[model samples]
Target: MLYQLRNAGFTLVELIIVIVLLSIMSIATFSYLGFGAQIFSDVVGRDQLISQSRFAVERLTRELRNSLPGSARVINNNRCLELLPIHASSSYLELPQPGQTNADFVAVPPDNYSQGVNYEGTYLFVYANSEQRIYNSTTQRKVISGVTEQDSTLIFDYNTTPTLFPLQSPAQRYFISTGPVSWCLEATGEIAGQQQLVRITGYPLANSPDLAHGDAQRAVMASDLYNNIEGGQLPFFTIAATLQRANLVEIDLRFARRQGAEPFIIHHEVHIPNVP
Candidate 1:
């Protein structure tokens, strides 16, 4: 009997079926990996947002806590908070008024100043209870010309014209300041038409809050800010001090990791002592 020779090879139908199965499996595998990658990206974005928001909030809180009483003012359409930072604070021994013979010297406890405390370019403030008193009134604010160390006291002398303080602190507290500090949420070009929170300093003290300056130093505190100011949602609000309460600063910051994404929001309140 003669046996016919048969070729041993995969048929066309079997090859096509195998190829289809392989394609389906590949698609499934890639889909799973893509889903995992998306999850990781979302998590990273959320963590980044939290970290940025926390730092900005904490810094603002600490600075506001140390600021002079009644010095906090919201300017620039409620987008900026301006205040004078206190470098040193203590009870004053003497403040020369206009009628007093010694119109140049202010005495304070010697221990308040450290060995490195520089008096140059600093200011002295007394009984600054309102924004007007802190910013506009010259009688309540004086620039320090020199500082002297005595046996048991520290004296700050003013070289400018001597004038009497309009009001005196009942607690006799005196506050020392270097200059004004401002925190503002403004637009920037770094992120393509996005707004960011910035801390500005090294600018001259102005009677009105200066909104823009070329020489001032600005540092970004937080990025991706999405606060809506025109819709009645403001980032900063000041609750004036009442007889029964202290001054309150309300901070509301809204951020987003990407454009068109839901915002991550933070609400904080800082209570400032009304001891001025």
Candidate 2:
């Protein structure tokens, strides 16, 4: 039998159809991949934001709990919290003997030395007489080891009424210095520029509440701080205290994104120690 060789290749129409099918499938796959990628990115970004916000709140809470007496106060329409932070908190030194004056001193342990407990450099100091936090320059200059009741190292004399001299039985009082680690909102940020919470270190060189208009020492503690008026949260920082009395601090934080989902709100109420 005379057998003829048949064409093994596909027809032109078949080839065209296959190409079209492949193109369609490729487009669908790419679209799916892109959607998946976008979802993943959103989830990661949201998680990061949540974690950052929580961390910021936790850190602030810890510091507030141990804040020096009469140091924590809300200012700037509750948009700021002014406080003389602490270094290595320690028990107040013992009272001096008869006719002996003991300056402001804490018998800090050797281990805490690394924490910059000494008053060698600029630091925040709060003592027996502090109804409002003030930035004292002269006080930052003197830092002699050991407590001397007379001529204390810590700053005394405040513009506020009923100025404080050397505290009586100060050992029971609370005095804290930011000790290099301070707090400031950033001058610029991705979202909350000049308003983002930051951690400042070794700041307030001359000791003055008049914080620099634009400081670079601040490190971002949180971004997108909510200062809205919707939740009855007046300012970012609010303080309620009496002269040489108890203080009530209210910190309202809200984080909302311009894009993506809605933001979150966090509130913390902090009361200083040594309430008499």
Candidate closest to the true structure, highest TM-score: 1
Q: Which whole-number lDDT from 0 to 100 does residue 157 have in model 1?
A: 72
Which pairs in model 1 have colliding backbones? none
Q: How displaced is residue 80 in candidate 1, in Å?
A: 0.8
Off by over 4 Å in 2: 75-78, 88-129, 133-182, 187-195, 205-210, 213-216, 224-235, 242-246, 257-261
- Each candidate's clash count: 0, 14
User: Whole-model lDDT for model 2 versus the true structure?
Assistant: 0.52
Tens-digit lDDT track of model 2 for 52-167: 98898788878766655556654444455666555544443442223555422333332344432344333324343344233343322223333222323232222322222333
CA lDDT scores, all candidates in order: 0.82, 0.52
Candidate 1 at residue 70, lDDT?
86
Cα-based RMSD of candidate 2: 6.3
Worst 10 residues of 2 by lDDT: 155-164
